[model samples]
Target: MIGLAATPEVSLADEPVRIRAWGLPPQTAITLRAWVRDEKGDIFHSRAFYQTDTEGKVDLEQSEATGGDFRGIYPMGLFWALKPTTPYRRLIKWDVMGSPFLVHLELYPSVLLVPSEDHLPAVTTVVERWYVAPGVQRLQVRDGRVRGALFLPPGEGPFPGVIEMFGGLGGLLEFRSSLLASRGFACLALAYSAYEDLPKFMPTVDLTYFEEAAQFLLRNPKVSGDGVGVVAVCKAAEIALCMASYLPQVQATVCINGTNAVNGNFLTYGNISIEGIPYQIERAQTTHSGAMQLSFTLQDPRKPEYQDCILPIERARGPVLFCVGDKDQNYDSLFFANEALARARKKGKQNVYLRRYPGAGHLLEPPGSPFCPVSQSPFFPLPLMWGGELVPHCTAQETCWREMRDFLHSNLAPGTKSKL
Candidate 1:
C-alpha cells in the first residue's frame, strides 16, 4: 500500500504545503502526480518520477522535484504551477465571481508514466483552498456609489489599509485583497466596471469615485495609518499610479506589469480630461497546437498628442514600486518601469523603485500561483500569450511577492514586523 499526506493539512497559497509518501516498495522507482479541477471545471494534471529509498518512503521536502515542467527541492510553489498542456488553460485561475477556488489535491502512485485519468491512483482526497485565509472577513461593499468587497483582518484595532484593483479585464477580484488582509492589511477589492451594479465595460469614469473609496478607508476606524496604499496589476496599475499622483491620501503605490503612460481610454475629473496612450494589437505567431497568442504594442508616447498621457509621478505624495517582467507580452513593462523611474529621478524624487524579472510574464500574481504562459480571453476564445518559462516565472512570482509585501509594509506600516 502507498500512502500520501500533506503536512499542516491546511496551507495558505503563499505558504508551502509539504507532501510525504510512505508504504511503497523499497528501493523501487515510482511516479507521482497530482490532479485537480479548476473553477471552469477543467481537469489539470502534473506528474514526476522519483525513486523510493530503502525505507520505502519518499519525503518531497528531502528531494528535488524533477522530471516535470519544473524542478528544484521546492521550486517555489510547484504544486500551484502545474498547468495544462492545452494553451489558455490557466493553472492558477482567480475567481472573478467573488468566490475562492477550492483545490482538492490528490497524489497518485503509478509506474513511470504520463499524467492521465487512467494512471491516477485511487486514494483519499486532501483539500486546500487556494486564496482563502483564516480569520479574514469579507464584507459586501454597497456604501453609496462605492462597489466591491472589503477584506478585514481579525484584530481589534486599526490595520494598514489598501485598495486593490484589477486591470482592463474588469470584475470584482477579491482573492488578492482578501489574501492581503490575511497577511494583516485591511484590503478593499474595488470594482470599477464589468460586474454587478458597476459599469458594464471600461468607460470614461470620474477619478473622484476612486477618491471617495480611498476616503472611506481613511475614515474607517479599523484602518490604521493616516493614508492608504494602492495595489494594482496591469492596466489597473495605471490607475494606481494616477491615484497616487492625484490623491493626497494615497501615500504608497504598487504597480505590477504596468505602463508608464495612462492606458485607459479616458479619465475625467471635473473639466480635466486625461486621455490614455494608444496601442495596436499584435497577434503572436500561433503554434501547431492552435493555441491562442496575442500581444498589445503601445504607440510612441513621444508624440504631441500622447505627451499629455504621461503620468506625473513628481506629483505623487509617496514612494512607488514598479514590479515588471522583461518578457511581458502585453506591453513594454520594463521600458515603462524604467521610464517611470527616470522621470521620477529627473524630478528629484528618490522614492521611485523598480524590480524587473527576466523570463517572467505580464501577470505578476501573488507568490505560489501557477505560471500561466497563455492567458485565455474572458470574452472570447482567443488566448492572450503570456511570456516566460515555468522555472523563472515561479521564481519571479516568489521574489515579486516578497518584495511587494515588504514595500507595502514599509510604506503602510513602517517599522512593523510582517504578520506572515
Candidate 2:
C-alpha cells in the first residue's frame, strides 16, 4: 500500500488541494488505499474498502454521492491527503489501470474502533420479509449470515436471480444488485472482504463463497433459476466473469471493469477452451487506452481444468450486457468486454450486449447513489493516466441505465428461472 498522495485535500470538490487542513475538526476521517478507483468516481470516493463510522455519525468526512442511479438515497464520501489548493488531480497511480493500486485516507473524528470479526456486515434480515418488490419477492430458501439491504422487483411466483460480487474491500453497499432486485429480480449485494473477522490485507481466494451465495439466491422461491445473472466491479469483476463461464446457475453476466486473467481457482478467459465459453462475446469499448495498455498477463482469463462449467457464458443460456466507460483509462471496460463478446461470436454464440460510456470512468453506472454526495470528497486521479482530460459528465452513464433495464426485462422475462 505504498505510493501515497504527495499532497492533501483542503476544500470542497473543486480540484485537488495544494495543502491539507492543519487539524482534525468535527469531521470524520478515513484511510484509502485503492488507485484512481472505480464505481462512482468524480464524486463519491467509493472502493468498498473500510469505514469507521461505528457510531453512525456522519462527520465532515462524510460527504454526499452525486447523481447516478437511485436519485439520492445513498450518500458516499472520500478523504484524501492533499495540499491546500494545488488544483487537485484525481491521480491515484502512474502506470496500469488494474494495478495493485493504493491511495490511503485516515478520516478524522475517528468513529468506530473497527470490529475484528471479519464476517459479512453486522446486519441481518429474514429475506422473505425483506422482499425487494411488493409480492414479487419470495423466500423459497435462505441460508448464510449477512448484513445489508436486498433489492427485489415486482412479479409472480418465479423470477430470475442475480448476485453482485465484489472484493472484501468492495463491500456490499447494496447499490447495484438492489436496483436490479427492484425491477422484479432477486439480486443480492454479496460482500466478501472488509468484514469484521477477515485480515486487513488482500489474499488469493476461491469462488466457493460466491458459488454458495449464487446457489442460495437462485434457489430462493423468488428466483426463477433459469438463468442466474451476476455483475461485478473491479477485482470482483474478474471473479464474476469466471463464474459466468463456470457456475451452472449463472444464466447471464454483466461483468464490469474486471480482469480477464485467470486465478488459481476461478476459470479465466485465456484458459477456457471452446468447451467452456464455446464462443466469444463482445463486452464494450472506450477511447480510454490506459486500461487496455494496463496489461492482462496477470489476468489469466481461463477456466479451471474442470470437466464442466456450472453456468457457462457461452451457454449464456440467457444473455449478457457488457458496460464500460470510455474514459475508463483502465482500458475502457467496454472495449475489454467487447473483446470477450467478439470471441463468443466467432464461436457461433450471440447473446452478449456490450455498452461503453464516452467520458465516464469506472463504476460510473452504479444504481441509487446518494445524490450530490461529492462534497468534502477526496479527488483520486489516475495521475499518470489523466492524459490532461477532465472528468466530464458522460452520456454513456444515462444510456447504460436504460440499457440495463431493457436488457434485464427482455432477457430475464417474467416467471422464468433465468433460463433461455
Candidate 3:
C-alpha cells in the first residue's frame, strides 16, 4: 500500500503545507506531481523527482528535489512552481467567495518527463487553498463611483483600512485584498476601469474618483482608521503615488513594481492635469516566444521635456514604501523607484523606503501564488514578458508579502492586534 498526505488538508493560501509520502520501496526513485485548475478552467501543474529514504519515506521538508520543476528542499515548491498547461495563461482567482482551489497531488512510480494519464499514480491526495479565512465577510460596493468588494476581518470592532488596486488589466482583483482581510485588515479591492459601468480604458485618470473611494472607506463604521493605506501594482501604483501626494486621507502607500511618473494616461484633479510619459512602442523588442519585451519602451521621465510627468511624491503626508523587482521586464521599475527616492530626498522627505528584490518580476503577488514570467495581456495583441526567474521570484514574493503586512500593521493599525 502507498500513501500521500498533506497536513491539515485545508488552510489559507499563504499558509505552508507539509507533504509526505510512505509505503514505497526503499531508496526508490519517484515523481511527485501537483495540479490545480484556475477559475477560468486553465490547468497549472508542477512535478519533481525525488528519492525515498532508507525507510521508504519521502518528506518534502527534508528531501530535496533532484530533478524537475525546481530543486532544493522547498516544502511549498509544488504550489509556486506550477506552470500553465497552455503557454501564457496566468493563474488568477476571480471568485474569492467560492470554494478554495483543489490541488491534486499524485505520486508516480517512476520519473516521467511529463505527467502520463496512461499510468495510474501509486498514491493520490488533495489539498484546499483558500484566500478568505473562516468568518471573514465579503461585501460588494457600488457606492457613488467606487466599484469594489470590501473584505472585513471577523470579530472586528473596527479594523485598519486598505484600498487595493491592480494594474492596466483593469477589472477589480480581490484575491490579495481578501487575504489581507484574513490577516485582520478591512480591505477594499477597488476597480478604476474596465469593469461594470466604469470606462473601458484609462485614457484619462481622474484622481477625484480614487479620492471618493478613500473617503468612502474612511466613512465605513467597520473601518477604524481616520486614514487609509493604498496598495497598488503596475499602472495602479502610479495612481497610488498620486493619491499619497494629493489626498491627506491616504496616510500610507505601497507601490509595487510601478512607475513614478504618470504613465500612458493623463492624470486629472480639478484644474491640475499631468501629462503621461510617452511610450516608444517602436523600441519594444519581440521575444522568440512572441511576447513583447516592454522594459525599454517607456521614455525616461527625468528628461527635461518629461520632467512635468514626474509625480510630486514629496507632497505625500505619510511614509511610502516602494517595492521593485530588479528583473522587471514590464519597465525600468528600479530606475523609477530610485528616481522617486531622489526626488523625495531632495524635497527633504525622510519617510520614504525602498525595498529592491533581485531576479523578481512585475507581478509580485502574495505568497503561494504561481510565478508567471510571461502571460497573455488583455490589452495587447501578443503576450507580455513580465520577467523573473522562478525560484528567486517566488522567494521574493514570500519575503515581500510578510514585510508588506508588517508595514501596514505598524503604520495603519499601530496598537491594534494583528492576526498575521
Report per-prediction Cα RMSD to one decimal.
3.2, 15.5, 2.1
List per-prediction Cα lDDT, in the order shown.
0.75, 0.43, 0.90
Comparing 2 and 3 on lDDT, the stronger one: 3
TM-score of each: 0.90, 0.51, 0.97
Clashes of each: 0, 112, 0
Ten contiguous residues with the weakest lDDT in model 1: 96-105
Rate residue 277 of model 1 by lDDT.
67
Candidate 1 lDDT by residue in tens digits, 241-298: 8898888988888999887777647877767788776555553456455554445457
lDDT of 2 by residue, 270-334 (tens): 34433322222132122343222222222223345422432234754556667766655433355
Best by TM-score: 3
lDDT top scorer = 3
Off by over 4 Å in 3: 414-420
lDDT of 2 at 359: 60
What would the per-residue lDDT of candidate 3 be over residues 157-238, giving only the tens digit for each residue? 5888999999988888899999999999999999999999999898998999999999999998999868899999988998
Over 4 Å off, model 2:
1-149, 153-157, 198-202, 263-315, 367-394, 414-420
